[model samples]
Target chain A: MENACCIVGLGAISSIGLDVEENYESLQSLQSGISYPEFLQTLHKTDLPVCEIKKSDAELAALCKMPLGLPRTVYLSAIAVQQTLAVIANHDMSKLRIGFISGNTIGGMDRSEYFFTDYLQNQSQGQLQDIRYHECGSITELVAKHFGIKHFVTTINTACSSSANAMIHASRLLKNNKLDIVIAGGADALCRFTLNGFNTLMILDSEPSKPFDENRKGLNLGEGAAYLMLTSEAIRSEYNLHKYATLSGYANANDAFHQTASSAEGNGNYQAMKEALAMTGLTTSDIHYINAHGTGTGNNDASEGIAIQRLFGENIPPVSSTKANTGHTLGACGALEAVYACLGLRDQVIFPNLRFETQMKDLHFSPDTKWQATKNMQHIMSNSFGFGGNCTSLIFSKDS
Target chain B: MGVYIQGIGNISAQIFDPRSQDFTLHAGHGNRLICIEPDYKDMIPPMQLRRMSKIVRMGIACAKAAMQDAGIVKPDTISLGTAYGCLADTEFFLQKLITQDESMLTPTAFIQSTHNTVSGQIALLLNCTGHNFTYVHRGHSFETTLQEAFMLTQENVNCNALIGGIDELTNNAFNIISRFGTYKKEDEHFNNEGKGCIAGEGANLFVVNAKDTKSSYAYCSDIHVCSTENIAEELDGFLHVNQLQASDIDTCLLGLNGDERYDTIIANNIRNVKNARTISFKKYCGEYPSSGAFAMALACKLLQSNTTPMNLQDLNAPLNDEPAQRVLIYNHYKNQYHSFILLNRL
Candidate 1:
């Protein structure tokens, strides 16, 4: 279909790796990147494990060729976006109607948190430059302006589902002929604000997260940025682009059950998965694998597991949560997992759900804990459920 | 096909009601424009009201009000745009995390601090399990939300999308932003040739449908976003795309804040517009990032009432006194992000 949104380029920066190739390598070897915070200066750093990218903001800035003292979010986003654009460097970018749609929970909060430490005491004490890019759009603008993306630029902040919605919106825009190419995904940097915020919620597991495990404690906070260059099938054909995968179906549904908790019945999760599959005109058996949101939280695993059971029922696919390796990256997780899904489809492999032992009693299926090569793996489902009851499911089909 | 604004509910610096031909614009207090809020008891439940921050309260109240005005108990989708999301909650959590060393922090403030809290709350309140999204793209936040809603309606004819734009002006935000010189001096207003604009906060919600209903205020014909460079060319293209000309527009609403530095671009662009009565909305709603929403609401009001409000001003040369059948809204933020919205009388 000419309306199909094709993923032509991929970029990612997380604890496991700095770019898509490194991330894929780490995933293949089951190299978990969870460790205690070394770069982040926090009181709870010793207790809380995180998927830090193992680089300071200065190192990231050096990599992105941008100035230091800016928010880490900017550096991460710039690096990922640069890598994404590098894949399409052979194409005449200026000739195409290009746009950038990014998703981030806190714009420059990494810098703003430092500014707030002083400004909270005295309004005039903080550096103006530190807090200048505090708005989420500001991060988007800094990157877009640097890369010269002036056509369409926006930000989505639906908690964890932020980047998933960004991809969804980008596809809609492409399907509607609003833009020929869109760099759509999200980024986030580890900071005290989110650390303590999630800490206060008491969902921070002391160890690396074990998603879908029966004895899962909670989610370990992680930080990263990932992006996918999506283009219309027409543009893909015209440019003879190297296709990674096709963004077949997606849906955003509200749980409406609680402010931060998923429903017991996983109503929103079920609806999002159901609707996404419906959009693809595919049945449960058509889906080859599932990348579960599976935050390793007691609430999320149960709710999401029950929803998966309700949807696929007896013929559940090999489901796994990569958060065990990357930790829950929150806003960036959706797109991060999406890149991984594309990688899985490309290689016809199912990356195991790391550190899973006992299965949840609420469901009949256990997440695949061993990496294995598979045949005829055509479609993979990625789930992202966030705070405020925001649930989104995205389905990616292997390029035929 | 264009989407119709079936209903509007605004909680802004001004008292706006589409049903009322005559309305009042409350004067801003010092350098900031505060919303003249309504009682929350009527719109939200008491228990839920206590947990919600000021922005959430205003957002949910106005969303419910818009839904009620649209004569629907639930909408097919709920989307919101907020530039500064849940400032009070964010500030509360940040301050507590700082002062108390993040030791005894609670989850309430942190829970409410996310940008989608308001939109999520609206969905939870109505038990409307549909598509929910929140855009925080600075100036184009609301316009992006409107665009998303418009696309949904165009894709699905039976979709009724509840969309809104909201932002709150907290004390800390005001103080810090004042340091950035975003607001005029305390002694200065628009009339005094100020270098900055007043800080404004508001929640404007609308129920839009692809099919026009009896309660529809106006039909939103087109919405376009463009960069600062080649704005005049883009403006002409926008009009041409809509099968219109400068003369076809009865009223052109420009986002001209009192700030001379930023308003110059808007001022310079108006030269390309001819035979259209130009109106500035910042004078009434003050200046906020998503104030384009207020401009669109005002355009709907003018179209619905068929009479101009008492205190409305024409920034450009006066034109014929005919009621506006076609309205064009041009808004830019920091001269960086610009959008044009066209509305027509039903």
Candidate 2:
């Protein structure tokens, strides 16, 4: 029998909040964390709005009890993973086989870009320590070592959908009986490299993002880290764990349409949602809420909306894009939104999509724009699509 | 279930033409072993080829060649691993953005700077809308790709996975990594006792299926990656689970990169094995995060030919006269990321 992956703990550190409780409170009050950049060293700070965490790198390091000079990505990840490990503080976890699967597009580019400024001037001038954590895997290794997780650790980079893939890979490990507990998520820090990269693509919105809206200009880049602690069914039963939800179904599909853009018809989006639902043996009407991958971009919202319409049709559930609040945390959005989805099941509340005024012309359904209490919410779906046409949808069902 | 290596393609420091009998091994040139790239005119169109970065071109060429060798038009899945992905493009955009003050920059380099660009471009070129994935773990990157491919084939019997591992060594990357004592100095001698190994880069791809076919090179039975202190015990457990022993392995491909710090893991395992012929592969391909792909390709070549290649006869010592049937590949990166892959002939 295939083992069911259970979500026992959740940790999140984003622009709106520092912990899951803070995030939930913000979601309850319909507060958006989108603002101008204060920490990232970029020239377009005034012109570009981002969902940047207010803490500086040094502040974050001090807060997380980590070394001062490590990459901000490491600091953010340490904070989130620390919170995640807190759930099992009373239990001795060293005996269990734990796996750490982290996803990120930018590893230490926040510092590597600074290293390059000097190295590009003179080949041997830059400090080698700055580029030490340049590889994406290095971030995971540091965080894993910090938490003393030594069994199995890996890194995945599938652009914006990176963490979603990490969670899926973690579930696979659980199903294969390779691990007892898996902490999977992703983290990305705002750096000049990615900011300029998005700017070059003409996708950075000057204002707060408006996902699933007719006037959606583009996505505001964000920085954050989030993680979900999953365990095998056997481990869950053995521990008699307090379950938030069961990661009942998930799937990954390739659009193959474009490198950075989604197809108009959302082929990959449709396939991923369909496959995930099929895995859960659930029909369209069963999903009570959807945390859409609506990045407020012209291509993503329309494509995702069309896919939702095609799948749910007249019986579309309460759908909302938290990107308006979180400002599209890139690689971390998948797990971050996943935590929100679990909160929807736990607290029975459907978080609102902020700044959404007019509906898009292609879709018939309008997203939920106000925070409302939902009764008897059973299953919530979280969608994450990224560059390279990587699309993933994860379904979390309330524990009966 | 084990997966069959139906086809293989590699672009490495050594000459990698499968049809040609002559395999020329290139020595490291001043602490770097650069890939002897083949002309991509035949594999990629001129218009699209113009905009591709070096790693992307190498990746696409290898993927296409592997597909041709497998005689398949499309694969059921596309997955890959790269430690330093599209370094040239990343450097280009970052340099331009910094030099131009982050204004008036073009999007081409920025668009291709992502780590998944090669896998994405290959999917775009092939129009294969399968489940695409990319892994960026330092040393275990390629092993994770293989594991995912194995799981896909295990889940769906009809799945054919086109998977590979690729890394490109750019000038800036080499210089930065060199500062961290990752590579030998240009004036230093190349010896096992040295502190650093030669830096290298390549793209090695394979077409894998669940069942053995007429063109099968070898069957990958098991793969494991972990960070452990007692490698000898781990090796015993791995072999025990696979229903094998140290003596059952005919040959063991060891990643003995010249560095003593890194080679200790492989050295510790070599002391425990009894009868397996130990051979180090880093001399041919040098040291990179995903160099295990090159080692796997070499293992597949040996298994397919049922004999040692002439170029690798003196890796550590002369190969055993008997034809090898089973091979074990053990590799590690910076003494942390350890992996073992077991391959056997049909």
lDDT of 2 at B223: 95
> For candidate 2, lDDT tens digit of each residue in A1-400?
1556999989999998999999999888888888888888888879998898999888999878989888899998889989887878888777799999999999999888888888879898877878899999999989999888988898999999999999999998888777889999999988888888888788888988889899989999988999999997678778777889999999999898999999999999999999999999999999999999999999999999999999998999999999888888887899999989888999899989999899799899999998989788999999999999999999999866
Q: Pairs clashing in candidate 2?
A: none
Q: Give the per-residue lDDT of model 1 (tens digit) for A1-400.
A: 3366999999999999999989989988999889888999988768998899999889999999998888899999999999999877876767788999999998888878878889977778999888899988889989999888988999999999999999999999998888889999999999899999998888889988889988899998889999999998777888888898999999999999999999999999999999999999899999999999999999999999999999998999999999998988887999999999999998999989999989788889999988889998999999999998999999999865
Residue-pair clashes per candidate: 0, 0
TM-score computed on alpha carbons, candidate 1: 0.98
lDDT tens digits, residue span B222-311, model 1: 899895498888898998998887888878888988899878788787676777787778777778888998998889988887565445
State which docking tier applies to candidate 1: high
Question: Per-residue lDDT for B334 in model 1?
Answer: 81
DockQ of candidate 1 is 0.84
DockQ-based CAPRI category assigned to the predicted complex of candidate 2: high
Give the DockQ (C-alpha) for candidate 2.
0.81
Give DockQ per model, in order. 0.84, 0.81
lDDT of 2 at A154: 89
| Cα distance off (Å), candidate 2, residue B220 | 0.7
Error of 1 at A59 (Å): 0.6
In order of the candidates, what TM-score does chain B achieve?
A: 0.97, 0.95
